[model samples]
Target: MNRRISVAIDGPAGAGKSSISKVVAKQLGYLYIDTGAMYRGITWALLDQEIEISDTAAVKAALDHIELQLVPVEDGLRVLVNNRDVSKEIRTQYVTSHVSQVAAQKAVRTKLVEMQRSMASVGGVILDGRDIGSVVLPDAELKVYLTASVETRGHRRWLELKDKEDITLEEVCRTVADRDTMDMERKESPLICVDDAVVVETDHLSIEETVQKLTELIRNAEKGERHG
Candidate 1:
């Protein structure tokens, strides 16, 4: 690699950003970050401490003590919350359900965004989250907004949750669309595509193709910066 560049990937649920971001990071020898998981880890912390999701004051206090760490691993990232390994715990359905709520808090967002910025200051990171390009790291070398039709994204989520639970495509579509609307309509920081961000519609794309597209974007960005 000529130079390490930070990549920001923003997308709604089941848009294939996480998997493709990981693969792209690995191919570029960069650190991969799932910002969604950071929120999930925070939710796990709050739940483990029995903090009410709606109690903003207590939630902020609890967030004061919890530490979410993203450690580099060979294949994927290892997520740690407050010294304990809550990687698997954060992925539970409970955490998934509450993560958006926890993340919507301004105080919580402030803390996590600070942590994310500290982690990505060194570059060579591919971060996937709702606000990475829009709010988290606006100056990232390359920003990508991944998207797909609600029906397509829903079907993908259905397949992913097929073995885990009995979720139908119709239910998946409704949930996915609802989540998308919530993420975009939230008052804290609506998920929006920022200037200079590349929009990639992943409705009919493979993970490999998506990764290649993102990697090419980063390469071109780096090349332009060097020449300019």
Candidate 2:
């Protein structure tokens, strides 16, 4: 059997990291680990308990009591917090707005990064998040920095959640911009492209095209690894 390779996809918010990583993982038969969901899971739990996200101590305290699990399902992975499925809940606008604050906590990042490392240790995993390439999986065999224009990213997100929420495209665009600033400026594991990571610009690419491009990147990486 061929050795399983770890893939890291890192990018700013609404850059299609989640969607693209999922397809790439499916194509390569690798486990898809959405690190952002883990943070969102915690954020949802914090919101459920009414804990202020900016209060690092409170967030860390909450983390001590909750368990986050990502279980693979037919459609995709289901995120569970304290054994309760919060897969849908975490994507809410409230959680989306507060997730960056919660994720920036040092203790939160440390714990989640540990969990992420444990999962990727087995290889054959595609982990996507702001810091997957820089912090969680620094030595991953394949590191891809996927990005798109803020307008494009916001438009994509608006399309995904517009029917479910009472938000406008402009609002989503502002949120995306805010998230990019937070993720980049955060003291802990800020979003950045590693030196060796291949950058994929997806501003104009279709979903299938993006997936196909990443799939080929993985295949080429594998071939290079074998030859090396």
Candidate 3:
């Protein structure tokens, strides 16, 4: 029997990390760990409890009591905080606006990164997030820095949000740019493509095409690991 391996996909916002990772995981029979949703869950909890994100002490205190669970659903993943399902709540505009800063918080990252590491320790897991390959799972069997042009990512994000929000394309593009800066400049575990990670650009590739490409990389990695 072949040993299951861990795959880490890191990328910027609007880069289709979540969607691509989901398909790849399903195809490979691996557990997909939605690290971004975990961060969003924390963000939602802080806002729900009225805890100021800038207040580091308060944020650390809240972490002690907060509990998060990621349950897989037919359509997508469901996030639960303290036993309460906030799957839809975490995707709201309010949470979307504040998630970057919340994710940047050292205390928040520390707590969540530990959980993410534990979850991936068993292998056969595919995790996509800003820092999965760089920080959470540096030793993942396959590390992919999936990305695309800023304009492309912005347009994709805008399309995803158009039906849910009354935001314009330009505004969505600006938001994606702003998020890129935050994710790259943040003090804690900033988004970066590790030296060993394979960079996969999706500027012109369809979701199916991108998935096919990554799936091939993963299979090759598995073969190499087995023979090595």
* TM-score of every candidate: 0.92, 0.96, 0.95
Pull out the clashing pairs in model 1. Answer: none
Question: Mind giving the per-residue lDDT tens digits that candidate 1 earns over 1-228?
Answer: 467888889988889988898888788778888888888888999999889999999998887698788877776878898788887788665676677778889998898888889888998888988999988898887888899999999898778777887767898788888778888888887788887778899987888788788888888877755212
- Which candidate ranks first by TM-score, i.e. highest? 2
**Model 2 misplaced stretches (Cα beyond 4 Å):** 225-228
State in Å the error of residue 141, model 2: 1.1
lDDT at residue 218 of model 1 (Cα atoms): 81
Clashes of 3: 0
CA-only RMSD, every prediction: 2.3, 1.7, 2.0
lDDT (Cα, tens digit) per residue for candidate 2, span 105-140: 999999999999998898789999989888898888
Q: Please provide, for model 3 over 1-228, each residue's C-alpha lDDT reduced to its tens digit, 9 standing for 90 to 100.
A: 656889999999988999999998999888999999999999999999999988989999999999999989776688999999998899776788889999999999998999999999988899999999889998888899999988999898777778998888898788788889999999999999998888999999999999999888888887764311
Q: Residue 28 in candidate 1 has what lDDT?
A: 76
Q: Give the range of the ten consecutive residues with the poorest summed lDDT in model 3.
A: 219-228
Model 2 per-residue lDDT at 4: 73
Instruction: Tell how far residue 176 is off in model 3, in angstroms.
Output: 1.0
Q: All candidates' lDDT scores?
A: 0.83, 0.89, 0.90
As a whole number from 0 to 100, the lDDT of residue 102 in candidate 1 is 82
Stretches of candidate 3 exceeding 4 Å from the true structure: 225-228
Model 3's TM-score against the true structure:
0.95
